[model samples]
Target: MVDGGGAIQRTTAQFEGPRERLLCLGPAALRTDELLACIMQSGNGKQSVYEISTKLLQYVGGVYALADIDVAELLSVPGIGRAKALQIAAAVELGRRIVHKPSDQRLQIRTADDAATYVMDRMRYLKKEHFVTLLLDTKHRLIGEDTSSIGSLDASIVHPREVFRFAIRRSASAILCVHNHPSGDPSPSSEDIAVTRRLEEAGRVLGIEVLDHIVIGDGRYVSLRAAGYMDN
Candidate 1:
């Protein structure tokens, strides 16, 4: 007797509601294209969800490649519109964060390099400026992180109140600030220096030490403290 092995046909001939299939077999059992089709939920007038997902996977080379795919690239595909593209992007980001999330013990930030490396993968590719604060315990172990601001950084938008709110809640002994430059240049502007100084002052008043301010670029980073901008 001979046996044939082929791809599992988990759903009906018409591609519909892998949601029910997922509920029965769980996510791990579904194929990658099927999983993507589930995330998209529906397709455009021209194609079915499954066909669009297969095209997307082929265009990007594979599922892991989606990690580095930008919205423009996703939109370039035949059936992917802004809404579906954003949905896929959001799902990808959530999965990335979850994978990088620490286990039993919290990760520590011991130096400027450590801080920058921790956030580089998460913030490096953002299209706009994102100001995030790393809350730390006495030993400098990371306790929490807050994305306090999402637009261009300035005194008003990256205000002291928003920056330190999460730190206070977590009772963090110190904070290391991180933000990304969409232009992929880590050079500190005058505003960047001014913002660091202001944050340091606020940290003093609030009894939370401002350890460093790291500016993340494409694959590079600049630590404000290392550059003497935080000497005062």
Candidate 2:
């Protein structure tokens, strides 16, 4: 039983065993709860925040589920007081923002696969469909990314005007539409094709070229343009 003081008192023989050392190896390799406990460095007389974070992860299902959780839901977990909940929320948000932010100043989307690789790590785990637009300059460098819609498993409501609105505002020369299928199938549905066609035609008139439409699935993705849908 570790107390709320940064002190590991009363080490059981079981804990001192080689198996335990192998499991609780280093701070860098600790599980989410252990890492959180390291940050917290203490418990609240009963259990450590590490233990609480472990319980919270279990209650929420896992780390991915926890990412989808809101502040209220996170706060409801034991030992994850308001401050800790906010901290977790903030950390997740920071990670999200980092992923969305363009990394390389010279990053350019040369192909559908390139675009997919950029957003895959962020969108693949989403529980719901999210329609995002990547705005690009004439050189194909990413200027911005916008979430046009979010919806249930079947569909996400989006408007061509909404998609281009950000492009126009940012003076982007082209755009690539990307979305995630929580069902883990990257195949484009009839509705997906229709939406892409609509956006393409709209972009034609607006002088903002529709570069491609990429559908993200579980560890896989499909580019409508690369599949010959856009050219046809």
Candidate 3:
């Protein structure tokens, strides 16, 4: 192609889309929209995959926000159909599982900070609250973890039986409770304190210690024990 300055430009360079760029420079070099486009695979007749992917991101706010959206919501986007929506949802779920997956090396939750850091990435981007239990062995190393309840935007209905049932099953000597605030603020609600105290009392009866309750925010975390909420 000839530019206004009469300089010959490589037309091929201009035609290189995300796939070509990804092949040349790797996925890490592609922008968020480009990555989404690759997952989408194709676009509607009138629009390019790049345009569709960009619109999808804008509609949901951002790439991180995609994690919270379901297939029904994805269908509302201009160029996304059932197939594309399913593909995108699957991709998001896979990403979530990968982040939440346990490592080959067992993780030890020696302190509240350790527990918070362990669940931070998995919980931080969620749109709804999740009450998760970190079941720790005698040495405070993670033996297993489970989500006790997934609830509304602000609350999870957690019962001591549900929480301890999983702990007893896993043979956990101590439990670290973790949950997230979709609002991105780690401040403890009155309900949070009440629930923690309830769990602590239950733990005492079961002879299992409640180490702490860690509230996860956007990138911040608050340890209820450190904040004096777990004092006897």
Q: Which candidate is the best by lDDT?
A: 3
Alpha carbon deviation, residue 71, candidate 2 (Å):
2.3
Where's the lowest-lDDT run of ten residues in candidate 1? 7-16
Q: Give the winner by lDDT: 2 or 3.
A: 3
Any runs in candidate 2 off by more than 4 Å, and if so which? 1-26, 38-48, 76-81, 97-104
Model 1 residue 18 lDDT score: 75
lDDT of each: 0.86, 0.82, 0.89
- Give the backbone clash total of model 3: 0
* Model 1 residue 119 lDDT score: 82
Write down the RMSD of candidate 1 (Cα, Å). 6.4
Q: Can you tell me which runs of candidate 1 are displaced by over 4 Å?
A: 1-38, 48-90, 152-156
Ranking by lDDT: 3, 1, 2
Instruction: State the weakest 10-residue window (summed lDDT) of model 2.
Output: 14-23
Models 1 onward score TM values of: 0.70, 0.79, 0.86
Clash counts for the predictions, in order: 0, 0, 0
How far in Å is the alpha carbon of 65 misplaced in model 1? 12
- The sequence of per-residue lDDT tens digits that candidate 3 reaches over residues 158-213 is 89999999999888999999999999999999999999999999999999999999
Candidate 3 displacement at residue 162 in angstroms: 2.7
lDDT tens digits, residue span 1-232, model 1: 2236754554463334677778767899789998998999988989999999999999887885687677998999888999999999999989997978786988889999999888888677766788999999999999889989887432225889999999999999999999888778989888888989999999999999999999998899999998999964
Candidate 2 lDDT tens digits, 22-123 = 455654545666555544445667985557767877888777765567799887887777777777788788878876675557579998888999989888
